[model samples]
Target: VFCMKGDYSFERIVSSDVDCINLKDPVPLLYLKDHPGLSYNDSSYSYGESLSEFLRKKDVGNYSCYINANSPLIIRKCPYDPYKHHGDDNGKVMKNCRDNGYYHESRDGACYLCRLEGKCGCEHYGFETFINPQKTNETGRVSACGSDHVIFSDDIYSGVEVIYNSENGLNEILYLDPHGHKVKYGMSGF
Candidate 1:
């Protein structure tokens, strides 16, 4: 069973459809058992609990049951951020997840899809610490997770300015070329 980001609050029971099987206490199903002769692989540091075991908790997060993929079955819940998701604090922002709830590192500005529990790609960007986006209203500045700068759409090619160098951690002003692509003005052209 593929438990989504907020599925930890409910009980998920799996049972075989064959006759005489008790439905009250259905056995936690395994994907491997359903597909005979298929190899079962787990690559996570912690060999996590079974689906039935994971379904017992009430934490608000995401988890999975023996996916054929190499990723680990880890449970995670995104923390409440009034500025990141929306104005309210009623946990309704979970709907924004997998929709537009992603932002980049504060220093690099490279976009990441999922930030489980708000842990963005800081480590991947070579930053030892996660730097939250600064809240700004400047026309050309990027305030990724800020109240007015939440990345609502995936269209990245339009209305972009100022860029941060991931390697040097320096900000650079961008100028749109005649072709409409953003480029750093230097010896090349205006």
Candidate 2:
């Protein structure tokens, strides 16, 4: 594994023992470049800093990078003025994993998390969560709908099954147990 030291410096570590551990600083998992002067870190990136603090310290000209809330591995770029993306005080930027600078919308009865490779179909992770009702009365609106979340760990059938349903607009979330039984929860718990 290789860990980053500074902006461009890296340290390479090679180990044979199974229990060997390297505690050095890791490379930033992702980079969002609008210009050249700004960088970002998320809770998952292990950088001992926050986006709010990093922006405060540097003289970011017109653009800055902040952690995208949808996924920690994604870093989103924004205009420096107005503190954050328009109308969103949490600075929750959506992921644009396509080359055309757009995000993949939830469709086909599943929620998709884009892969590291840009513009390809979501082969990395997917979820079956609540869908927003188009109107006050929407069809396929189940009083209780369970998700069929799928994670392609190695692009194979091997999986570590878990349960979850993100709230979009449905009334309740249903999680599946290891035995494929439904476990229900109200919208508040989601």
Report lDDT (CA) for all predictions: 0.24, 0.23
Residue 123, candidate 1: Cα error in Å is 7.4
- Candidate 1, run of 10 with poorest lDDT: 20-29
Task: Identify the runs in model 1 with alpha carbons over 4 angstroms from their true place.
Answer: 1-89, 106-190
Residue-level lDDT tens digits of model 1 in 64-142: 2212212112222224333233213332332232122232123332112223223322333311111112222333432
Candidate 1 Cα lDDT to native:
0.24
For 11-79, candidate 2 gives per-residue lDDT tens digits of 677765331112211112322232233233432232223322333344322101122211222322223
Question: In model 2, which regions exceed 4 Å deviation?
Answer: 1-11, 14-114, 118-130, 138-190
Model 1: residue 70 alpha-carbon error in angstroms: 14
Per-model clash counts, in order, read 1, 0
